[model samples]
Target: MFELIGIPPQALFGQLLLGLINGSFYALLSLGLAVIFGMLNVINFAHGALYMLGAFVAWFLLQYLGLGYWWALVLSPVAVGAVGIVIEKTMLQRLYKLDHLYGLLFTFGLALILEGIFKHFYGVSGQSYTTPDLFKGGTNLGFMFLPYYRGWVVVLSIAVCAATWYAIEKTRLGSYLRAATENPRLVQSFGINVPVMITLTYGFGVALAGLAGVMAAPIYSVNPLMGSNLIIVVFAVVVIGGMGSIFGAVVSGYLLGLLEGLTKVFMPEAANIVVFVIMVVVLLLRPAGLFGRER
Candidate 1:
């Protein structure tokens, strides 16, 4: 059967695992984008740059501060999130009353500035980050070899995604956020500081990107351009999932990742463009996205 398909089970399953890992990142990043767009109405092009910052911060902690992967896991996201809070309060807040184009342009410029600074300082070369000691090995799963750290990444990502979904969909704080986004004046009248909520929501969204960066550092080379390469695909994921639907973003991310993996197994040459192709199809069929409701 394997020969009939012209591929071995090991290779198929291996690609699937890799796809899941990539999907994990997509889900996390797109979730952040969805939250920010849904609440703040900003495109946030700097998200990828902030992601890079997270990985670099992790590298800096290990290199200069004599810290380890564990510390990086905890601190990197918080540090980048702090930067996000500052940007939101000082710059992004000013553009909120303006056209959405202003927000996109501002973040695009911010991304360029960030990427330029990092490239100049760190050089274009990639940095290495070792997997944590606890997750340094692999397991034989009868059919395929599973790396402990990779497995941890998938599990942790799923948990975080689920937690975020729950918070936004079911919690009191989420209710306030949703309400404020829909009607800031009314929500403000009810004594819920809408501005503060927006600020925190942006921070939280960026922090999710940072967390993904930290998770990715050990798996891929920590290069300045890493996020730039990945962000486009994530944006495509967002479009396919629908810009306004959180559930759509998460589900489409994983599904597309799996599809991409299958594409690699079946047609290696088409793998790179498969996501975009699917995005075009999805847009044509359902402009509001699979889970998005028409406004």
Candidate 2:
């Protein structure tokens, strides 16, 4: 019924909603990076590959095992997370005593290898995933139409992010996790099995990436490079929010998403680089990030 700055309500709200959906993915992916970096002190450059792996896992389950989208939703993360656990135990554990750059380099190389292998077999083309019948339609919300699957993605992403934040910020296990990262010797003295905790933390972190991949599979084509396409932007979001800041990651993800959407409406050309531009400003203004504490 009304227009804002000459843009119709449908166009404005539609972009905002699209932005929110993108933010949901950003929040999930960045949350995982924040957790891994904050807890394990590993840069985890392979996170994008892990995300791609998750989507591929889902597709594999469907193509090979006759599993459905629901099955992929539940199993893909677990399968990819297990892969993370193995990577941590077999490879990443050795880099713990080294510099952060080493971890980054190691993971970056691993990402290349994984992507190469998949590309050799699957090629660079994107694979299609059908949306579940449960969420195949859209709801007309007077001004704009909202896709059911998208709404589900936003709701589920928010719920998962909230649950993760609560578990890490408000629970006993989270305290132990924080403690182990801070003082491994003391935590180990208490018989907490610090190594195991670290391993599991890494697994859980990548699992978040995996879950995001599964969620994205239907929306975006399940391509090997999908994660690579988004990882940089997600990293920018984490930096803007504050590296290792859980609350910051979640907040920045959605906020940046909205901003990007708005930019698209007003300045389409700058939409792609808007997130990085904000990141540069944030870095210059506050090196520690919006939610990051000064170390």
Best by lDDT: 2
**C-alpha lDDT of residue 133 in model 1:** 94
Error of 1 at 8 (Å): 3.6
Instruction: State the lDDT of candidate 1 residue by residue for 70-108, as single tens digits.
Output: 899899999999999999999999999899999999999
Candidate 2 positional error at 140, Å: 1.4
The residue pairs in collision within model 2 are none
Q: What TM-score goes with each of the models?
A: 0.97, 0.97
When summed lDDT is taken over every stretch of 10 residues in candidate 2, the lowest stretch is 1-10
Which residues of candidate 2, in runs, are more than 4 Å off?
1-5
Candidate 2 lDDT for residue 139: 98
In model 1, which regions exceed 4 Å deviation? 1-3
Error of 2 at 260 (Å): 1.0
Worst 10 residues of 1 by lDDT: 140-149
